[model samples]
Target: MEVDYSDIRVIGFDADDTLWVNETYFREAEEKFAELLEGYETKNKIDQELFKMEIKNLALYGYGIKGFMLSMIESALELSNNEVSQATLSEILNLGKEMISHPVELLDGVEVVLKQLKGKYRLIVLTKGDLLDQERKLERSGLSAYFHHVEVLSDKKEKNYQDLLSHLNIDVKEFLMIGNSLRSDVLPLVNIGARAVHVPFHTTWQHEEIEEPKQKTGYITTNSLANILEYL
Candidate 1:
């Protein structure tokens, strides 16, 4: 189905994987975390338990590298029956710090696309994660000037997007969201009667994975950020 973007007056961009490299760091951190806990359990089991810990603690810690670090620590303790060494815990903390301090690497055509769309429509960042961390990334990304607003949502449910649209004083049909995750960035906006475009990242978190079914028509999927320029 051909979706229309002629009415899109406000375009919301997902910051992390959409504009810059993010999930890749998380994947690397997870591998190191699994290695650290290998003595307590198999890497596979450690990975599974870490994921469970993260999901279990989502409400308490929300999303970000800090929460992920906490989950890693908790998973280590649980898997090791509290016998995991203090040295290993320190290493885990270091891993989190490394991720937090890592420089932001913008994806190809991110600047060009933002430049093309900046004056054409209201451009804002709609993403979820640690607010400070996200802000730091934005600062490092040098893309902050392109956005009119920046929102760090605790979660990306349909209601969250609805509230965002309401807060921004944007009509549902006039909003367009572009991002990497179909589950978080695309489906919720489409469900809320807004347009969305999916730009798949090379690596995505397992939590954000969704099975694509035929016949869904409210959004468009582009292979790169540059492709979004065609619609907007």
Candidate 2:
């Protein structure tokens, strides 16, 4: 498929999972928490419980370390019959904070692609996570210079994309979204009459994968970030 990015004045990209590694760290911590809760509940049972708690907490608390820590504490306490120690709760919260403060490592070829597109395109980083966490990562990665703007959203919905475009004074037809997920990234952009390109990540986060593609839209799929240069 040929993509005429020459008319695209602004190019927005997703941060976590799209530009850098995010879900892997979360999955690691969850596995450790599961081991800690082994005597209280089976792995499958714990995961199912945690999934429900995650959605609930996401609605109530939004995203980031606070929401994740709260969800973990709730899951642990419920599975342990409300007998979880204050010390364990403290430990879990500290771990979540640690994950945010951790190093920023870009995915393979992300830097290369960013370098290639920087001067030619109006690059913006549109990510959804805790504000501080996103800021810390951007500061550490030193890739912040490449972007014209950085937006940390509460969620990736059609409204978020629409609002962003309105704020920037750009029409949806003149913008392109590049990201790793079809669910949060591509589908929402397609909904707003914008173009999107999906660069599939190797490890899929449960919340990030889209089983069905949004139809009759300018959505392109690729296996790597470097491959996008051909279409552009």
Candidate 3:
């Protein structure tokens, strides 16, 4: 089905993975974390347990590297029967710091697309993560000036997008969202009567994976960020 975008007045972009490299860093950190806890359990088991701990603590710690670090620590303790060494715990903290301090790496054509769409429509960032960390990344990305506004949401459910659109005084029919996660960035908006474009990144978190139906509508998918320019 051909979707229409002639009515879109505001475009929302998901920051992580969509504009810059994010989940890749998390994958690297998880590998290191698994290595650190290898003595307690197999790498496979450690990975599984760490994922479980992250999901379990989502409500308490929320998202981003800090929460991931806490989950790793808790998983280490549980895996080790509360016998994990203090040194290992300290290393986990260091891993989080390293990730937090890592420079933001923007994907190809991110600025180009933003520049092309800047004055043509209202451009805003709609993403979820640690507020400080996301802000730091935006500062480093050198793309902040292109955005009219930036929002760090707690979660990206349908209601969250609806509330954000309402807060921005944007009508549902006049909004478009672009990002990599179908779960967070695409489906929710589609369900809320807004438009979305999916730009797949090479790597994604397990939590973001979804089953694409044989027949679906309400959104479009592109292979790269550059492709989104065609629709706009």
C-alpha RMSD of each candidate structure in angstroms: 0.8, 1.5, 0.7
Candidate 3 TM-score to native: 0.98
Which runs of model 2 end up more than 4 angstroms from their true locations?
Answer: 1-3, 214-216
Give the per-residue lDDT digits (tens) of candidate 3, residues 27-144.
9999999999888899999999999999999999888989998999899899999999999999999999999999999999999898899899999999999999999999999999
Off by over 4 Å in 3: none
Q: Point out the higher-scoring one by TM-score: 1 or 2.
A: 1
* Runs of candidate 1 exceeding 4 Å displacement: none
lDDT of 1 by residue, 80-192 (tens): 99999999999999999999999999999999998899888999999999999999999999999999999999999999999978988999999999999999999989988
Candidate 1 global CA lDDT score:
0.93
All models: lDDT?
A: 0.93, 0.85, 0.93
Better candidate number, 2 or 3, judged by lDDT: 3
Candidate 3 Cα RMSD after full superposition onto the native fold (Å) = 0.7
- Which candidate model has the greater TM-score, 2 or 3? 3
TM-scores of the candidates in the order shown: 0.98, 0.94, 0.98
- List, residue by residue over 1-232, the lDDT tens digit for candidate 2: 4556667878898998888888888888788778778888999898888878988888888877668878999999999999878887777887788887789888888899999998888899999888988998889988989999999999999998899899998889989999988888898998888888888877876766668643546788888888888866
